[model samples]
Target chain A: MANTGSNQVPTADVASVASSPRPYLPGDLAMWFFILAELTVFAIFIIGFAVTRQLYPDMFQQGQTYLHPVAGGINTIALISSSCLVALSLNAIKHSRQNYAAALLGGALLTASVYLAVKSWEYNELIQQGFGLSTNTYFTLYFFITAFHFMHVILGMIILGSMAFKTTKGAYQGKSLSGFESGACYWHMVDLVWIIIFPLLYVIN
Target chain B: MKPFGKMEYCWWTLIGITLFNTFLGEQFSSSALVSILVALTVMFKGLMIIDHFMELRHAHRYLRLMMRAYLIFFPSLIIVTTFL
Candidate 1:
């Protein structure tokens, strides 16, 4: 049979559909899935800790007494400030303000350094008090969670520093801002995680 | 793009709020309540980051729907498993 107009969908409509912006590209979706999986893993750890705390309220309270809230509070501010700097850097890049972008990255690096310094001080204090990873269940959880977060902070600083270097070298000038964008997203996620951990681990008791 | 500065201001405001909450949390004696409040603050911050910083606010409707689906569904599952 001869092809009829009634049987044919419009090519323009098909083209429009194909050209429409998808909710996520393959890479973005994959990255989001990876983050979700990582979040679930941390959730499991949180739930386990909650259950244990329920079982040993007194011990957990005692554990809380040993934590320094001042240090924890400082670290919270540091992470939040770092997130702000990264975000500002992303905005500056979008605006083609290379100098400002570099400045923001420098700010982020400085904040990360402060965070690490305070963290080391806290760790040293804890160690001096004999509260290592092997100390007890509470200490184990504390050390593991904070250590994992510290590693992320270090990673985020490296990413920010690299982006700064690229900006100075005139990279990311015309391309889509996806690289800096994703790095900022990941850094915010790191900050978000620490926000939860701050209260749960230190201030809660 | 037009409201980029506004978005930045909002995010900075959120950071300020979170810092305030952090200070308040340090003063609270009840761990559970403090933890709950802190969680809520962080959730708000997360929403701001996703909506503004990630540029998801200007995304297509279907994409927003999908995001809402993920946000609601996964947390629900976790809560169900934890409670029941």
Candidate 2:
């Protein structure tokens, strides 16, 4: 590996900082905008949930009786763990620790799997109990919001998987890390959404 | 205290809060005070993610504040709508 400078910071990184000056934003500017847009859409949906719950407080209360708080708790831990791993993975990659970063990405994927598994278990249980989206207003919103988030989780895993592949090949070493940072940042957005959703759906009830 | 030598400390705090929220959820049904507390917790968790996990504390002022708006807005909305 070519040594860029005494700070051990790569030339690309030094260039990034010099170009931006102090108070660096860590990922692609476009990615940040994308995250904001996504957040807006979800905000609308959650507000809908709140309004509908207000309209039919009894129905929502009935719905909450079936939710498993323990499962939600486990899923929260899983997603937060995955987010931390992704952040640490980016930190490792920034330092050019490619293999370690790749491993961290793998760990992130594994933890994310825990979230999916717990969610799937919840969905299956809800379905087996004869609850469907059409069951009532509450179930409909529940399925819609969570299914949308579930799809995002799958997409995030794909992005992380691609990053892990490229990391193992040293694609980001001594090079611009914008692509990797963008992907990592996206994964964190998923966790961010869940951080609210868990309480909104399961805990608030 | 090099409290944040790594992401370790933030991660642990998040885990603790998740468990706490779970406890709150199970221990009490939906009430005004509980709802407000839960919404506040959402804001706290949002700040933790934005500052630490997303590394936005050292970020540009405008961009960081944009993210902050989302994290803060929704929870506040939840609080307001709770009273509605």
Candidate 3:
């Protein structure tokens, strides 16, 4: 309710505006649907990982031995850091802080790159040790799940890169932020999935 | 700390939770209790992400419900399958 001079502005006039709930679902409708679809795929892979581990405890246990839990922890921190950057960047955009948002998004991209580097190094080490997809059921599912997620991280990095570029141009300043929100949401999904993946794969054992 | 908004607080708590969960998980390993704890931790983290990070707290009811369901169901499924 904008203040008026006399201060007796009719209550009925602004009642709806003041009373109505702003149930804002951030991001594009299409993006939410896409998030749901992507989550469904990841869910299936994760469930498969669980079910297969049940069937082959020994294999899964051995596979866990070959994994680098320390690396997993590092990647977890990296992803979480990136997610935080994405969220903070969007918040910056909301405040019309373009350069700050761009810097944060760039930080996000860099953190995600850290995750990619660690993951790729882990993959290389595993391959050098003869742990390919065909190695066993455990390695098969391991490669299947992690590789799928790895690709998503790469895609997320691309999205963040683009978002950072646009942020620098002041494109989102004082504008409808659905696009900015969507990219941030996607990066967060990648992070959310990792929050589950790291504990399940490396910590829970 | 003085100027932090809700999102900043959420971010800080999330970092704390992640590190804490990692520590607890390592300490307990694969015990039945730790397994269940892991499941619950995942749920908590998912809720924080979907509701807070994703800002779905004020979104339509079903969207939050659906995402919540996914986070809950999978961890529960893992717990069930672990004993099978």
TM-scores of the candidates in the order shown: 0.78, 0.91, 0.88
Q: List candidate 1 stretches off by more than 4 Å.
A: A1-30, B1-8, B31-35, B59-84
CA error at residue B38 for candidate 3, angstroms? 1.2
Instruction: At residue A163, give the lDDT of candidate 2.
Output: 95
Q: For model 1, how big is the CA root-mean-square deviation?
A: 8.1
Q: What share of the true interface contacts does candidate 1 keep?
A: 0.27
lDDT of 3 by residue, B17-61 (tens): 777766765565577777777788778878888876777676657
The lDDT-based order of candidates, best leading, equals 2, 3, 1
Candidate 2: tens digits of C-alpha lDDT, residues A93-142: 76667899899999999999998999999999999999999999999999
Scoring each candidate complex against the real one, what DockQ results?
A: 0.34, 0.64, 0.52
For model 2, the stretches where C-alpha displacement exceeds 4 angstroms are A1-23, B1-6
Model 2 clash pairs are none
Per-residue lDDT tens digits for candidate 1, residues A62-152, read 9888887778878877877787777667667666777888888899889888989999999999899888988888888888888988888
* Model 2 complex DockQ against the native: 0.64
Candidate 2 similarity to native, TM-score:
0.91
Per-residue lDDT of model 1, residues B1-84, tens digit only: 223566568557776865666576567776445555555565566566656544556454664565545444433333343332
